[model samples]
Target: MVPEAQLRDDGAGLAPASAGWFVLNARDARWFHRPGRGDSVPLTGCDELEAETYFPMLGMSIQVLPPGEPNATYHWETEQEDFLVLAGRALLVVEGQGRQLEQWDFVHCPPETRHAFVGVGDEPCVILAASSRQFQKDGPWGFYCADEIARRYNASAPEDTQDGDVAYGRFPPSRPTRYRDGLLPD
Candidate 1:
């Protein structure tokens, strides 16, 4: 459980009654960015300061993608994942198909579903992502074909490369963001 000192009155730190459970409001959550991966604010129910083992059961995060920016490469995971569009608009690239998404749109991605997202329009697209944490025997993560749809938005992996082989050295390290106001829906 999170310590009393970390608890806040505005529902920023109200968590479940579990060993590592904790909470944080959108305004107070710390935001991070990975060079090519994009920006996100983790909404895990655990101490954010404790990076390694904060969330044990599932993983949750709010991803913010600017125009033409992508949340990640074209890939799928062994575990199921879901996404909710909170504000702005985006293009969902899944299984070589492209679908435009708007606020309140929910996407359900079953295991081994190839997918990625790219921000569209002038404003930033905010998405809430949730995924199962059940470990797999052959690893839960994998990258797939680089499609034309993903290439349009610069979200595709390098040509003729597999997962873990793509270089991210050109991208910037993930870091915290100061734009807390953007966390909320417009």
Candidate 2:
């Protein structure tokens, strides 16, 4: 990446006009947020989260994969994850394992638990995900998501609607980036 392409400000203290000369800017239409199939949840404004808290400050987003969809292909590192079933019903598959959940059910996944979320039931599956921190494999967050000990079950890019979460590259499908640098699963 060029110096200007990085998040850092240019030497002149302003963003370089040619920053995106190489990196393609995401399409405006693709930038919108539409959580579940029932309704579109577009953000009213741009947002950012600071990594600070008792447990690392987490960034969260809810996804509503209508019946027959799974989340992105991802796994955990030292970070654990918890999920709150907001609405509808679905099968939460952890690797080859599977479980049925309804609204209000709380599921806690320990660090590096091989898992994938597949939307099931007649209604849309709404879920809240919490992680330890923002994610990246080699970037600032240091999240090598693809190389995490856990591997993508291919459940991420569901070939059919009844399979899993559709590929919405908006955010990686890990849920809330919410753990501290030092947490161990109980």
Candidate 3:
């Protein structure tokens, strides 16, 4: 095993820094430079990418669209994305057209495009996706799920909150949805 002291690079904090600053380029240069088939990157969380990148130019992010799973349709703020499929198969449904994608396939997506990624295999559809710009200031991240789709994802947001504070339900000891018969006398 190489000593930690031996691996430090020019003190650019080459050392494995904190959670926010650690560089994930820890593998071989040749391997990454010339990746072969099935080089799926492991799924990472928001905390890791939050440090170096965010909205407006959100750093590169990789999302693996599982079998039969679809990425929530959304848009971004003038940001572009590069996607590379590693394993299985998938399709980029753009403007109602289905484009077949195989391993090692690259797809470029421009900003503000109403697009969605659909898994095309019975197996996990692996993909290595990246973006040129990071996330925008606030967000271009909004889901386009209708009432029917909401039930499919099993998600719900408060439609109306009157008589009680929204934070009341946000706090740890938040109260459950209280029903007032007078409010909805239907």
Q: Per-prediction TM-score, please?
A: 0.77, 0.48, 0.48
- Report the lDDT of model 2 for residue 9: 26
Scored against the true structure, residue 18 in model 1 reaches a CA lDDT of 33
Per-residue error at 132 for model 2, in Å?
Answer: 1.4
Better model by lDDT: candidate 1 vs candidate 2: 1
After superposition, the stretches of candidate 1 with alpha carbons farther than 4 Å from their true spots are 1-19, 35-37, 45-52, 136-140, 160-162, 165-170
Candidates in descending TM-score order: 1, 3, 2
Clashes of each: 5, 18, 10
lDDT per residue for candidate 3 within 1-186, as digits (tens), equals 433222233222122223333344423111111011122222222333533432224444344455555543322225676788767687666543567788888888777543456566766565667664455444543233222232232211123222123312322331212222221112
Using lDDT, give the best candidate's number: 1
Per residue, candidate 1 scores C-alpha lDDT tens digits across 146-183 of 67888787777666345444624335666555445654
Q: For candidate 3, which ten residues in a row score worst on lDDT?
A: 28-37
lDDT of 2 by residue, 1-186 (tens): 534333322221222132232232211111222333222211111133212321134534455666665554444445667888788786776644567889899888776565666667876676777665544323343122332212232344222222223433433433222222211112
Clashing residue pairs in candidate 1 (N, C-alpha, C atoms within 3 angstroms)? 1-19, 12-24, 12-25, 22-45, 33-174
Alpha-carbon local distance difference test for all models: 0.71, 0.45, 0.41
Using lDDT as the measure, name the better of candidate 2 and candidate 3.
2
Which regions in candidate 2 have their CA more than 4 angstroms from the true location?
Answer: 1-56, 134-186
| Segments of candidate 3 deviating more than 4 angstroms | 1-49, 52-58, 74-77, 138-186
